[model samples]
Target: MRWSKPLSALALATMLAGCESIFGSGDEEPITRLPRALTQSEQELIVASNRFGFNLLREVSARDTSSNIFLSPLSASMALGMTMNGASGETFSAMRSTLGFGTMEPAAINAAYRSLIDLLLGLDRNVDMRLANSIWVDQQFPLHPAFVESSLQHFDARVTALDFGNPASVKTINAWVDQGTNGKIKTILEQIDPEIVMYLINAVYFKGSWTQEFDPARTSPAPFHRADGSQHPVQMMFMRDAEVRSVMNDQVQMVDLAYGRGAFSMTLVLPPNAQPLRQWAAGVTDEKWQGWIAQLHDGKLDVSLPRFRLEYDEVLNNTLKAMGMATAFDDVAADFSGMSPRGADLFIAEVKQKTFIEVNEKGTEAAAATSVGTGVTSAPPTFRADRPFLAAIRERHSGTILFVGLIGDPRSP
Candidate 1:
């Protein structure tokens, strides 16, 4: 029922500039403008995403403690949610359990996702947050109408019929992905294979300015301590007595940075030890997460964060398989009976993600895209990330994390 409005020039610049822009677009994308309120079901869905998100965070950390990691759990969730529509039997059960959806009825699940999307689409008037979903089907493949309707109604996913045999299909799908991610990700598909009958994609773009902007002139060079105990000079952005919410314990300190009207904030957590934040990330459960948020109180502290940019790409097939989703990737054993008439033949070929984040004086600009390839597939206090730390962009009201990262080396983008 929603209609498109003209995109502003500022939005255009942010999309085209990717995350290199230090500040958000002068104008934000118009809010959803819808007057409807979120239902209880939708609210529960948000909570589910949070649970699934944190679990995934731990797995990501456990998999690679040595390298810097960044990802968009929201993007991956939505993409898989769409694909989940056509999943049946073991595939459905496995996906549901892995995503923390548990035994929730599919009807309720879709409704929750729909409401979550609508609510987020309208939450921040001053922040540009966009979520896009689409399905591309091979001309020769036959998709189920029920699946199509569910995706369109619940996800507002655009359905396109394409000839996968033609190379142009790759460009077309990539174009949609690029546009959805504000060009932060230029391509998601290199070449569509004949066996690849369809693709389910989700792209998210977010740009938010600090409620209290940092003075660029105050930025100075500071030494950033690496995990290896080496110090490297970095452009350290400084903030003094700025408004912030923080919490701490013997293990780590958490700091929250507000954006615009405060519906969203970046939570940074600094662990005391030189070990990667991943080592401790697995311990962040819903109850513990709630405890940290409840303990946060207003505080004043001098902050020093390195001005850095990170662009990361990761293939999640093995990680997901290890997380108990092995059957989905096994072509011979997989069952996607709900996706297409030939569901038995369709298996998730791969799962991959691309993310971009830039933190500077004004604010932060970040975008991420998750491609299922049929495929289907933190916090801080005291506040200095001079060493290794963890960061997450989350919605304050729902506690939904849109983006998360572990910063090990900032010297390279």
Candidate 2:
């Protein structure tokens, strides 16, 4: 969410036939569209999710107003949605309310997510977008079978049981995250805590080339003013004369830049002259956002945008708590019995996200990964056989005993 300096010129660009010099002239490709219309549930879910995303952004921005903030609300929602399947009682209610799910049942919510994922992945042939999910459980933890089944059926999440004590397990999980985000994000966890029993992860990746690319020759060094009144030189990309859709008012100017068959686009919002972007963004609501989007009309406008890249990482525990989800973080009050028979001991320990984004002459490339970790309130008792002990091998499902032995002295093998 790096803010570029306000454009020096906001007037319409001159109509010139020199398209070959300013924009690329390529054969038009067939537009790819959604396979089917969105179901009512899917549409509702998307609207609610957008509101949640906006709220989450405001909350995160309130922490440090000047810093660049970028996060994938989709990644966070999907990861939390998966975890929500394992919640029960007040924890479930709080999470559902915080996510803006309202009265939607769990089954309907999961179905909507599944349909939405399919629609997004198939929307545009030229755009590359992928979503992936996974669940990691400690070997000794007894997770509920129903939770595993639902995650696989609804979210297509990969489930694995790992030896959390082994340091190699950290590498294994990080490798999956690396692959999921196409290497934009390499690791989500530095180490697994001893009290942690499970982790739910989601990753999203997107790369799209602009419908009309900005010519590199037009890019020049320009002074970019910072919110702190500091000025720095930046590589500013210029579109001299392009038919761009835009909307403007006294407070801000908004422009839409389409990407690949117009299935997706990037909207650039610039605040009024001498006004800090954070000030304007803090007041942006869902209704205001929708109004701005609806007012966009086609026009020939000259655009000056700076190329930038950003990477951000943050722990969302406090953020979610402030958003009315405190019960989920409480070890004693949290109820996730749907996850395990011993759910009373389980609580959400952490919610973390890492994100990367780069916008250049071609288009935008972004990737993000979010992880939710659950930990036990107290350590489970450990059994140590310092004296004689009995050992047996048995089949769990059928309750068939295979072998038994009594060990007195290890030296007398």
Candidate 3:
């Protein structure tokens, strides 16, 4: 009963920036108007998406406690959101619940994503951010018109039909990824599997200069203690008596480093010296995260951060299955009839993601690409990052988390 033709979905995120002016000097105003108000459903969707991100992080970190982990939850959700259009019955319910969609109807989920994407793209003018989706189909596969129409209308995805049998199609698809991420990520596929009848992809790119740029002249080599009791020399950038939003308690020290008129920011969470980064992260629930964010306040402190870069790649089939979406990957019990008449035979074979990030005296540049084969399947602050810590890039107004990661060792790329 296993279907030979599988569906693949991919998502990517990239961030790029450089040195810029200081934020919150006490007199500056936001350059752009505030983003529009969100509907109740939109607001609910945002909460659900963030919860899903936290859950995913917990699952990924638990699997490997001493490695750098980076991912784009928004990108993965959007890609799967597009694919969800074709799911029905138990398969559909499993995905909706796994994504924290709760009782929201499928149409509501699609509408929320459409509105959210528009709002994110228009929020900060000084920052360059883009979200794009695409659906690539085998030339001969029969896709339901309604499924195609819904993806186009709700996800704003580009639809392309090509000969999956042609090797050149890989280049064509990767070209779109390169363009979407502004060349930060050039490829998402080495070769499309013949059994994969369609590929759904989402790409995100963000570039924003720090409101307060670090002075490269002040950078010095410092020791970064690893979680394993080892230490290595790292290029630690220092900013003394800088005005930024920060909070601290017995468990962790967190700070918000703003970008582009304070709309987008990178939040860094540093666990106490006695606590392992993984142990601290394991206790973070959605409520705990929200509480910590609410406690951030403007303050003056000395800050030291390491200039580090990391690249992470992982197959997420097991992670998603662990999150309660196992039915979608089950060959016999899965259902995707909403996508096409061949729904009974379609199952996700695999899901994969590759990510890259670099932070230095100037700014941050990050890129991530996630591939779901139907087969398928931060901050800152005074606080020095001289040890393992956590980071998240987010939009302040809507509380939308674009990226999140854990840095166990800065010396390892």
Supply every candidate's count of residue pairs whose N, Cα or C atoms clash at under 3 angstroms. Answer: 14, 0, 27
Evaluate model 1: give its TM-score: 0.88
Q: Candidate 1: minimum summed lDDT over ten consecutive residues — where?
A: 4-13
Which candidate number has the best lDDT? 3
Writing each residue's lDDT as its tens digit, candidate 1 over 1-413 gives 22111100001111111133344453554332334555767666767777777777777777765457777888888887887777888988888888778788899999888888877877876677888888888777788888898889999999898998899988998888778877777777777765676777788888877766677788888898887778878888778887788876675588888776677788888875555556677677767777888888887766777788766776777777877787777776677778776777667877777777778776666666666656320232346778888888888767788887687777522
TM-scores for all predictions? 0.88, 0.83, 0.93
lDDT (10s digit) by residue, model 3, range 175-198? 988988778888888998878888
What is the overall TM-score of model 2 with all chains considered together? 0.83
Model 2: pairs clashing at backbone N, Cα or C within 3 Å: none
Residue by residue across 15-88, what tens digits does model 2's lDDT show?
00112222224355635445566788887777677667767777877774435666666777888888888889
Query: Please, what is the whole-model Cα lDDT of each candidate in the order they appear?
Result: 0.72, 0.65, 0.80
Q: Higher-TM-score candidate among 2 and 3?
A: 3
Better of 2 and 3 by lDDT: 3
